[model samples]
Target: MSYSHLLLALSVVFVWGTNFVVIRWGLDGLPPFLFATLRFAFSALPWLLFIRRPAVPWQKLAAFGMLLGVGQFALLFLAMRADISPGLASLVIQVQVFFTIGLSLLTLGERVRGYQLAGLALAVAGLAVIATHLDATLTVKGLALVLAAAFFWACANMVVKTVGRVDMLGFMVWTSLFAVPPLFALSWWLEGPQAMASGVMHASVGVWACVLWQAIGNTLFGYGVWNWLLARHPAATITPMALLVPVFGMGASALSLGEPLPLWKLAAGALVLCGLVVIVVWPRLRTALLRTNA
Candidate 1:
């Protein structure tokens, strides 16, 4: 990657990393389901007017949207609203990596490598560490919800893999169309109509700004630039930068929200990141070694 492209990747990850903080701000007024409804609504509309839908089955699109918007984000927002801090939410959601691997093994009959198994074990250990340290800030319900969200995120990834390559930006927008109505219905049912009305009426400018940031900055700009980079470079070259997300998430939470980072948290992060390093980097190293030997 060129210096400029490197900066672009960094910017995308930064936006994504800080997005947890943005979600926390937005939840100050709106209920989780309502907040999620508005997020996908704004993400789809206006741009959806201009962007052509990708050439994929409506069922596939709808499935991906539901998995991503409702399964992943709704649960995530709810967890963050009451149970978990943004920093830990960011970290916990990364378990989707392991979930995706497990799903592929079961659903697609893909063989797991030694490194992947090692990575999974390490990540599970990290989760076990987190499970032992629950408190007012990090409740069991919150951890469970986030894990569910991560599972859904992994399911969404499977949908993408099945769909093959298409215009992902367009896919995101159109599928977002499928996500909105269900989310609105869910908000009405669970959060209550009165709460939704009150939230809309009393929403401050800052909260609205956070919502827009989630839609425009995090979704549009972040995914847009990320896909652009992937188009230009190898997946291996660009994807590893995602490891910075939790790092930035934890740092931003500490700086902005004053969320403390105890030794346990640091240890958990190290174990999980080292696992990810083995999964992502070890393959590249092995391939290079094989080429040199050959």
Candidate 2:
């Protein structure tokens, strides 16, 4: 990745990492599925009027949107509602990194070489530290749902990769159109009318602001650039950056949510950083080493 696109990828993950806290706050005043519905509504509408549809096929775009929006956020939000810690949720979702690599290899015949695989192993070990040190907030039900969300996220990565390059902003906005109906449909079935209505009526200003940020900052900018990067680089290279999410999520949680920054989490963050360094630098290092020997 170029320096500029690397910066863009970092920005995307930062917004996404902080978004866990935002989702927690939003869910406090809104039901999971309904909040998810409103999130897409705010993300997609109005802009839909301004931006032209992307050149991708209708079915492909719709499938990508549903997976990206519903398969990811709806299940994720519901898991959080089931009492998964925001920090843990962020960490566990990095399972999508492995899922992406595996699916990319199977579907696209992409190869994961020495440094990438090694870095991935280190990152998974970092996650294992956090997982083994789980607190009361970690539940089997929530973990299962989040892993499911991660799988859909990995599949959605392939969708964007398969579509290749196009208008990323327009594509995000358009895919969101397909996502909204299903979210509302599912919300109605899952979150009862009375429960959903009551939650909306009692929503606080903090919740409203969080929802707006989640929509504009997280959805528009984060997902837009993420898709752009996946289109620009190989999936294996682009996906490793997600390991940074739990690091950022843990820090954000400590600051905003009063979650303790345990030593193990800090150590895990360091391991993740080392893993990212290997992913970023190993290619150039190997090339230079070969050149010197020659």
Candidate 3:
């Protein structure tokens, strides 16, 4: 990637990394489901009117919304609500890589390469280390739900792979469109109508800022830059920078939320990042170096 594109990619990751902290703040004023409802609701409007809808099947788009939006965010929001710190949530969600690889193997009959298996082992060890401390800070239920969210995210990626080419921005808009009603219904069902209503009515300006930032900053601009970079560069080149997301998340949470960074947690995060590098960056580097030698 060129310097400019690299910078753009890093900027997108930073926005996404900080997003967990924003979600925690938003949940203070909005129920987890309600916050998700607002996130998709705001993301779909005005801009959705301008973005042309992609030609992918409506069913595929709907599934994408269910998996990535409702499924992922609901679980993630609840995970944070259970006292999982933002930085830790960010790191744990990287398990999506293992889930994606596993799903691809099962659904597509893809072979599990040695490198991927090694990465998976390291990733699992990293998660186990985090798991050792979960009872003290975050609940087991919360950790399990976050893992489920990561699984759904992986499933959503598979849906994207099946859909082939699309207008990423429009797909995102329409996915949010698909997510709104169900999320609101879930807000009422799970969070209770009265509680959700009270949360909505009593929400502070800071809450609104968090919601809008999530809609515009994290979802819109984040995906916009990501899709742009993907269009210009190979996915291999563009994606590895996202490994920095947890690094940013850890630092930002420490600075802003006063989240304590224990050495064990940091070590786990480093292991996770290293595993990601092994899976995502190593193959490309090997190929390049081999070409150079030849």
Candidate number with greatest TM-score:
2
Let me know the TM-score candidate 2 reaches against the reference structure: 0.97
Model 1, residue 274: C-alpha shift (Å): 2.6
For each candidate, the alpha-carbon lDDT, in order, equals: 0.80, 0.91, 0.77
Worst 10 residues of 2 by lDDT: 1-10
Question: Candidate 3, 223: how far from true, in Å?
Answer: 4.3
lDDT of 3 by residue, 1-294 (tens): 555766787789889898888888898888899999999898899777888888889998799888877889878988888658788788778677666666766886657667766765666677678667764666677778888998887787677667655687887888778888999899989889899889889999999999999889987788656755655643334444565677778778888899877898788778766766676666778899999999
The global Cα lDDT (0 to 1) of model 3 is: 0.77
Candidate 1 Cα errors over 4 Å, as ranges: 1-14, 221-244
lDDT order of candidates, best first? 2, 1, 3
Model 2 clashes, total count:
0
TM-score of 3: 0.84
lDDT of 2 by residue, 1-294 (tens): 667887898999899998999999998899999998888888899999999998999999899989988999999999998669999999999899999999999999999988998888888888888878987898999999999999999999999999999999998889988889999998889888888789788999999898889788998899999999999899999999999999999899899999899799899998898898899889888899999999
Model 2: lDDT of residue 39: 87
Scored by lDDT, the top model is: 2
- Whichever of 1 and 2 has more TM-score, that candidate is 2
Off by over 4 Å in 2: 290-294
